[model samples]
Target: MHIHKKLVSLITLSLVLLNTTACSQRIGALNDTLKLAFIGDKDVKLSTQQVNDIPYASIYAQIGDMSQVFIVLVFAEPKVSLTQVPTTLSTELKWLSADKGMIVTVNGRLVRTHNNPTGDLVAVESTEPDPIMLGLQLASTPKTWTRIIDWQPGYHFGYRATSYFNLVGQEKILINDIPTQALHYSETVLVDDLNIQYQNEFWLTPETGNVIKSRQKIAPNLPFIDISLLKPFAS
Candidate 1:
């Protein structure tokens, strides 16, 4: 009877260990499944009411100038606000509040910005470089060449690297049925170890030095992203 009782206790312990291991494996598999689901979802869709309610402009980013994939650029909701106003501006016209400041979002996700010192757009988030600033810099600066540190976001990790920009010239282009004066420029990024050179183009409004259209390459593995300003936000 003593030996039988000892055998029964041993079997019970073995079953407990097996059940614990199985539960751990199941939890790990669940975690992996969640990660994959998050990674696979790339599109972020906002309702028309949401877009109209916010003080934001809409721009479309096309991949490679060929692929059907398109990404929308706008400010992320709730986290960003346009509450502050410029004191010296005309009292008759109400503008979007800039008190809370603004942020640039790509596909509803925050990317880096290239702040143009002369332009109206400003970077509130410090983690990413501002592309709008870069566009304004290219438009306003008299110098023919300049360099910038650009940040590219990724799935798990992002990278920042030096990129060079050159002012190509100025031209009048008809965008959205309007004849607009724009400053043309080109950007070149060199990936040293990869020996890959990526080229991008930009057209900024000459008056405000804001980016009107652009062909930007954020990563060597990704296609060139073309952005066109659909319309400016109406206050």
Candidate 2:
């Protein structure tokens, strides 16, 4: 039976999170301090109380365009040439707590309720996670680097912190009241048995020091996961 793309994608994305977030601080950058995160620009004012008094649960954060997009894409696009989505101040995404499990909803509609082992706890609006379909069944898979590029601090950049499907990720960052850069990161993991690789790019606003947007793509030609931040209001 042919599986629906949505289900496949979400499952894959789910698996990706499991492998990517489990690394400890000593293992690599996947730590509480330097987590593989995409917090928004530090310059913007954020609404941190949409759910509990503490910054918990998923959020519909609004991404302001006043900031700038990361520059890693400019350096790596020539090699991967994946999609580069725009950076909107406010977009569609379930912002979860930096730690612990989170429940997501929009306009009072349930979205997702899962805990990211890496500390990020939110899910997209029915988009398939990007690993199950790509054959990232285990985190101890072999991998290769298609290209190496430099990313100016603040924008996004992709690097292999592990051997799993190389992670192609990004982040939008704003430092100290200015749209400093976009923190983009991506890693392409290679599982020999599957013969497929993953290329993902995330867009986040450093102004808020949180991931405002994220996108992912599979090899040979497949649709990518596009996520953006939505404005959070009193619930």
Candidate 3:
């Protein structure tokens, strides 16, 4: 009778051990899947500084009818960082001048422009309107008719004016076989008694609002800039 009792006890112990091992394996599998999901859904922010000899952001542009592509490196800082918010991304573009830049809100609203010709970055003051902000607004709000403040940077200041955006239409296009949507718009700026015209186009991913390609005319003298977001480097 003692031998039979010992046998029953051994079987119960073995079953408990087996069940514990299976539960541990299942928990480990659950943890592994959760880790993968977190990695895939995390947002990424990058700068112009190279990582393993690869730049974080690279933009390629080709002027009108030009076969050669011009490259622009995008950097990140308080100056030029695009911060991801719950709804949209807030962008700030600082010109070569440390004191001059434009800030756009998450909803693509041009909040302000600052200048510190005194060479003090900390002493920047919101002084005038910005034309670059107008271009950005056009890129962000393609479906809405928006009025933009137009200006061109000059030696000491920027030429300021008002402009209106008119949407041409939307067309289906393919970038690297990824079907995309594009919006074409024309802008008319009124300065003094003269009117300046610009044509803007933006190719974007409909789901993410990521701009794949863009063509913008900042000034008549400056080259009409065409920008294509470089794959593998664009975050």
Candidate 4:
């Protein structure tokens, strides 16, 4: 299931909704692709209405130039979904695409990926707790950490990377027309061995610190994947 190489800058998409009427209309228009999503269409889209109408929790996922709505199908250890969202802090989420591609995340961080377009992320590991698991604590100040990552297609393994995080302050955010103030944080990751550097961002709820939205890169060259919780499970 290789997606089109054409990229839709996730940064630009971050500004897609601004808690306004126009934003709602735009969202509805974007999700008009739902009719085609089931057929494995590329660049698929989803609406908050679609999420609400569904019985299961859902997520809006985008990789490369394709986007789709995935739902929770299995809720257990390492919660699984046929493409989806995360429910709580320090939780592992496994999302499966229409064609059976899998993306797994821990604490809202990309941990592994399989059957991706360009390649796959074999795994990401760290001896210490990932800063994200700390949730709201990470927002108090800037911090840094390190981790080792492995990838497939080229047998790349054991590449270490350092990540620096800085709080970008609280801001008004709207999801599914519900308004809330969320903490924004910026993350920069550098892998000196591969001469690779990438940026990731997260928006966490002020209270529970659950990541409601994020833009993350799985490997050095793989395009960033965007995941946004459209419907969350009860805590």
By lDDT, who's the top model here? 4
Best by TM-score: 4
lDDT of 4 by residue, 1-235 (tens): 2333111222122232222123344444433333335435445555567657644445667776665545332232444332222332345666544455667766567888877876899977666556777664544533787888888788799998899988888888777667877889889999998788899989988787788888888788778888877777543
Residue-level lDDT tens digits of model 2 in 113-152: 3442222212221122223212232344233323222122
- lDDT value, residue 69 of candidate 3: 31
Native-to-model Cα distance after best TM-score fit, residue 46 in candidate 2, in Å: 20
Q: Order of candidates by lDDT, top first?
A: 4, 1, 3, 2
What TM-score would every model get versus the actual structure?
A: 0.45, 0.26, 0.42, 0.73
Off by over 4 Å in 2: 1-180, 205-209, 218-222, 232-235
Considering lDDT, which of the candidate structures 3 and 4 is the better prediction for this target?
4
CA displacement after TM-score superposition, residue 28 of candidate 3 (Å) = 38
Candidate 1 lDDT, 41-158, residue by residue in tens: 2432333443333233444444454322212222233232232222211111111111111224432222333321212221222332334443445444433322223333334132
RMSD of 4: 10.2
lDDT-wise, the better of 2 and 3 is 3
Worst 10-residue lDDT window, candidate 1: 90-99
lDDT of 3: 0.36
- Model 3: per-residue Cα lDDT over 33-102, one tens digit each: 2232222212222222221122123334344454323122222334332322233323442211111222
Global lDDT of each candidate: 0.42, 0.30, 0.36, 0.64
Q: How many residue pairs collide in each prediction? A: 14, 75, 0, 1
